[model samples]
Structure formats: C-alpha cells, structure tokens
Target chain A: MALRRQVCFALYAASRATTALYRPLLDELGLTYPQYLVLLVLWERDGRTVKELGEELRLDSGTLSPLLKRMEAAGLVERQRTAGDERVVEVRLTAAGTELQARARSVPAALVAATGLDRKTLVELRDTLTTFASTMDIAAQELAAKKK
Target chain B: MALRRQVCFALYAASRATTALYRPLLDELGLTYPQYLVLLVLWERDGRTVKELGEELRLDSGTLSPLLKRMEAAGLVERQRTAGDERVVEVRLTAAGTELQARARSVPAALVAATGLDRKTLVELRDTLTTFASTMDIAAQELAAKKK
Candidate 1:
C-alpha cells in the first residue's frame, strides 16, 4: 500500500495542514501553535503547575521550560516557584494573557470559517480523532509496559 | 464547547502522540521525527526536489529550509540546486542515507509490534481518519477560493 495514501499519513497530513491554517492567524497575534495551546489551557483555568500544564499538553519539561520562559518574558504569563512545593513552578496568566483570550475567542471561529467545513462535519471529525487518539494512547501504554 | 476536546485538539494530540511513539525507535537511528518523515518520503522514491518534499510533507519553505539544512548537515542527504531551475533544490540520499534505509525497513514492523491495537481497530481508525482528512482538504480549498 502507498504510505502516502495510508490513513495514518492522512491524519498526519491534515494535522500539519490544520496547524498551518492557524499560522497566518496566529502569526498576526505573535504566537506559535504550541504557545496558543498553552494559552488556551491557561485561559480555561488559571494557575496550573508546570507538571499539570505538561501533562495537559503532553509535553516534557525540556520543551516546556524554555517555552514558558519565553511566554513569561513576553508578559503573557507569570511563572512563580510555589512556596508550598519549591520544586514546582506555577503558571498563571498575566493581564495581557487574560486580555489575549478575548482576541483568541474569535480564532476558533475564524479557523472554522477558514476551513469551510460544515459544523456537523467538524464535529464528526473530532469524534473520530478522539477515538483514534484514545486507542493510540492505550496502544502506546501497552507497548511501554511490554518493554519493561 | 470544551475547546480542549475538539477534533482539532484531538488531531493535534494524536499527531504529537504518533511522533512520541516513534521517538525512542527513531532516536536509536539518530533522527528526529521530522527528519524521519523526510527519510520516509525519500525511501519510497530516491531523488525529490525540496518543493516536492514540502508538498508531500505539507511543510513550507519556512519550516523545511532549516530542516533540510540539518538533514544535509547530518550527511544523510545532499542538496543540489537543479540545473534546469536555479530556484529549485533537489535532495538525493548519500551513501549513508541509502544504507540507513536497511535500518529503517524494520521500523514499520517494530511500530506495529509495539502498538497493541488489533488489525481490525487499526483498519477502522485508518478509514475514519482518511475520510476526515479528505473532507478537511476539500473544505480548506473551498475556503481558499472564497477568499480569492
């Protein structure tokens, strides 16, 4: 079978394409896709620890540390070492970060508009993606277990 | 709606997860995910131009330039400006690159063995992803047309 035509290939392709779709819009806002993802999580609930954010984003500290530092420098978020747990750093949105949320609220709508996919189709796609993701997660965990 | 649980989010999650699945295996061969993807494309067919690679990989010059440069630096691929089109760069595998193919051939089987999803589940997931990707592509084109 042609790898290009494989379902896994399509998923990978579409994911990249979708992220690219956000590029122009996000560039205007001075954000990368991962940064936007972090912002989204923060906007939804403020003051999440580094570990919590990493778990939510499925990113490791190696990637997240510099990213959060950059975000902190940009004045979008504040990172403070927790008093209770000195080892833990908490990330909370700054005023600018919170304000950015209002601007970002329109992004998803713009993306849907940009994609031109109907609402129903988008929902269906998301459902299938969730199913695939969950299955893959289970598969990865099982693989990891066998290795140990 | 929970933006975190949306199809776009799930798609992004799955894309990252897929790469993570490949991380340890690809690391053994000293390749990053994007680098591995480039090799995957080239393994299927020998010489391809940068533009062709970008199209197949769904990456633009901004992302591919540095990536290809890194690959070229690694001695896995050689980049030469095509005689016919000075603007075009063609990537051809080096001796090391060709040799790496033998090492990479086992990757698919390893991934399949590592991922515990049954064949039936994989097939179903693949079909759903294919449909979702095709529909998304159609929508993207339509949106582009409307803007033009």
Candidate 2:
C-alpha cells in the first residue's frame, strides 16, 4: 500500500508540475491542459470522429462532449457530422487552429526550461511511464474481457 | 514533445487507474479517493490544520476547505479553530473516523487483486515514481524560490 501510494503520489505530482509548466504557456494561447490535449490529438490527425478522440485520450463521451463544445466556441476546432454517419460527430481543426501550432511550437523549449529536469531523467521517466501505461492498458482490457 | 506527451499520459493514466483501483474499495467504506486521502492523513496524525493538510496533499485551500467541510458533514472529522491561532482550522478524526481504519485495512489488498499487477512490478514502479517525484519536487521548489 505504501509503495502504491508513492507511485500514485509521483504521478499526481508530475501531472501538476506538467500542468503548471503549460499553464502559463497555454494561457498565452488561451488554452487549458485538457483543451491543449484535444488540440494535440487533432494536430496529429485532423478530422477524426469524436469517438476516436475519446478512445485515444481514454476519455468517455461525458467528458469529451462538453470539452469539444467548449473548443468549438473557442474556434480552435470545428465539429461536423458526415452525411453517411449522421450519428457520429467528426472534429476538424480550423485555420486558426493550424496557425496556433506555429505559436505553440516553442512550448517544448519553455517546458524544458521551466521543469529543469535533465534530458536523461526525462527520457527515463517517459520510458518507464510508457511501459507502465501499456501494462495497465492491457490489464484493464483483460479485466474487461474476463467480466464479459 | 513525444517525451512530454509520455509524461503527461503516464500522469493522467496513473491518476485514473489509481482512482479506479480505490473506487470500489472506498465505496465499501463510503469514501471517495480524495476523502480517503484526507482520512489517511488524519490516520497518520489527527488534529492537523487544514493548511497543513493542504500542503501534505499538494491541494490548495480552496479545494481542501470545501472537502474538509464535507468530511465534517459526513461525521468523519471535526474542524476546530486553534486557541493559539484563530486563523487555523484543526482537523481531528471523530470516533467514527478512527474506527473506519479497521474496514479500510483490507482495501489495499482488494485494489492489488483488482489491478492484477505483480508485486515485483508494483514495487519497481513505485520506486521509480518516487525518485521521479522527489527530483521534480526539488526542481519545482528551486523554480518557485527563484521566482520569489
């Protein structure tokens, strides 16, 4: 239990630190961390269905739907339904969204400067976390399968 | 950028996983994760000031104040103003709160069983995460100190 607490605490602290680093940067661009996450997903692949974004981000519709609506209001992204799949909502980046990328390009450097973690530590932490996520993802899936 | 995403993903994922792991167990005790966190702090040392609890949990007064209010309402804890300092609100567990430990004792085992993560992986992951958090905490303090 103590060990689990330690790991959970690290993850919690790291998330807060990362958000703090991004807070100032994203504020300049008028974005929150979760909003920025949505933009990142769209940046990687434009015009993805809302369900896809939910799955990729591991968020449920309850969280994403409202978030997407807010993003739409901010004009960073647009949501539209395809003629064939009226039930599905597809999200696409606006011209402003694409242009915002150039401004956000410096975010990486700013985060590095703010975090003050050495590259070695960052890489190692990332690798370990990635592995942990993969393991958890598999575990969650297996557990679901077993329930079914 | 990929590295930052990895770190953020890990943090977000781990937070969700930890909450999920605790949810069912906590439900049996009628506690939420944050509420459980509050209980844990009081378990270790009753009569901590709200400010102290906020610091220990890395939460802000805005968040902890309301949470403590709810916990007080739940009859798990009581908030008293310190005689030495009128500004301080001391949080002490109630008889009900202290007795809850017996019920919560088995929660950690249930969480481990649900997650299905091997003990070895859990330990290593915990160690790595703690190292990461300690390093980042130092860096954050140094950064905040510089700002001051």
Candidate 3:
C-alpha cells in the first residue's frame, strides 16, 4: 500500500523496525529493549529518580516500576529511598549494570549496520527526529494545559 | 546526556511522542493508536489476510492476533475464513469501522499541527523514515538468513 504519506505511520513502523533490530542483539546481553533504554539513561547519569527515568523513557510509573523490579532481580539496577526523603525512590545501576556498558558499547554500531545506513546519515535522521519529538511534546503539553 | 547521538533513542522517543499526541484524539474515537494504524491499512484495501496485516504493521501474530480480536469485538472490523481456504482468515472493516474513516480524516492534520512542523518538512521526515525502515528490514532479513 502507498500509505507512506502518513507521517505517524512512518514513525511507528520505523520505530518498530528499530526495536526488532535491537531485539536479538540485546537478548544476548540479557536485556530487553526497554531495559537497554533504561540502562542508556543511567549510563549517562548514575542515579536518577524513578520519576526522572520515567520522563526520559516517556514511560509511566506503572510500566517503569515493574521494569526496574525486573532489572533489580537481574542484578542490573537497585531502587532505594532517598536519604533526605523516604518517599522519593531513586534508581541506580549496580556494578554489574555499569559493566554492561562495555558489552553495550557495540550496540549502537550494530544497530547502525542493521539499518544499512552510514553513520553520518543516521546521525542527521536522529537529530531531526529528536527535534520533532521535542516540538510534539511542547504541543501536547500546551494542549493538556488548555484542557486543564 | 550526549545520548542524542543514539539513533535508536531518537526514533524511539519520536515515535512515543507521536503516539502520545494521538492518544487523546484516538481515545475520543474509542481506538488506540495501533488500532488506528490497522484501520489505515484496511481503508487503503478493504480485506487482507492476517499475515498481510501483520507484515504491513511489522507486528508478530502474537501481537496482531489479539489486536484484531479486540478490534472485531469493538465492531470496527470482522474476521472470517476465506471460502476457498478455511485456514486463511481475512479481515474486513465493518460499517462502523468504515464510517470511522471520515471522522479520522482530521487526525493526520491534527497530528501535523501537534508536531508544529510544516507539512513539507514532515513529509520529508516521513519519507526518510520509510526508507530507513525498509533498509533496516532488508538488513535484518539478510542477517537472519546468514544465521540460518
């Protein structure tokens, strides 16, 4: 079908393809795709609140909590209450989790190869998507505020 | 984080953003974002095999089967075994599903507005994503074949 004109479908399809490509590679690392993403966020910064991880992943606590629990069970991450406020739960990577970064170092390159695109071209596409996502987020926020 | 360099994250985040923007509009229509995608495919061609639908959406039977079941229950679509082949199920949009198309006409425009990008720019982005996804699919198939 010539449904290529639908921007949303393009994004959705491409996104799924990306995840599929990552699946086998990540399965070897004992990480699901979402878990890999959570690690990506944590690798960049060691300790983040569950709320912050949720924001980065655009996943609600309902989804993120169980994922963190699984990662904790796998010895990848640990979630504990903050010293200053027991109510605040912070998610941190364990030594094992941190070490996964070394294994994961090749993931991006493997993903790029899977796309059959040069790194330069993929970089440009990534930046464009990132900007579009940010713009979409702003519009969604404005719409929500208006509804409130 | 310098994670913007990660192409997968950009696509993942942007795809989520697009889905989030579609969520409220789709909720009003009693459809989820993925259901809307299914309709788009059917609207282009009235009936298709479950396998075809799975391919078009890049979803596995495990996922597509249950989704079609839910859509059938919602009266948006119907699935029946083809007369020539009892084993092959074909999905066709119900009258309600067909009518939903007119209502869904505005969805693309609303999504474009949400992205806050000119239609031309978004079109460029869509084409880029479609090509990238196709390339990735080919690469994946080759890798799978090699592994076999």
Predicted model with the maximum TM-score = 3
lDDT by residue (tens digit), candidate 3, B3-90: 6578888899999888898999999999999898899999999999999988888888899999999999999999999999999999
Candidate 1 CAPRI-style tier = acceptable
- Best of the candidates, DockQ: 3
Residue-level lDDT of model 2, residues A16-110, one tens digit each, is 76676566668889999888888877787789898998877878899999999998998999999999979999999999998988898888776
- For each candidate in turn, the TM-score is 0.81, 0.87, 0.95
lDDT of each: 0.80, 0.76, 0.88
Model 1 pairs in collision: A126-B7
Lowest-lDDT window of 10 residues in candidate 2 chain A?
A1-10
Candidate 3 CAPRI assessment class: medium
The TM-score of the first chain in every model comes to 0.95, 0.88, 0.92
Off by over 4 Å in 3: none
Better of 1 and 3 by TM-score: 3
- After superposition on all CA atoms, what RMSD does each candidate show versus the true structure? 3.3, 2.8, 1.7
lDDT of 2: 0.76
Residue-level lDDT of model 3, residues A26-107, one tens digit each, is: 9899999999989988999989999898887788999998989999999999999999999889999999999999988998
Which candidate do you rate higher for DockQ, 2 or 3?
3
lDDT, candidate 1, equals 0.80
How would you order the candidates by TM-score, starting with the best? 3, 2, 1
- Segments in model 1 whose C-alpha atoms lie over 4 Å from true places: A118-120, A138-148, B113-148
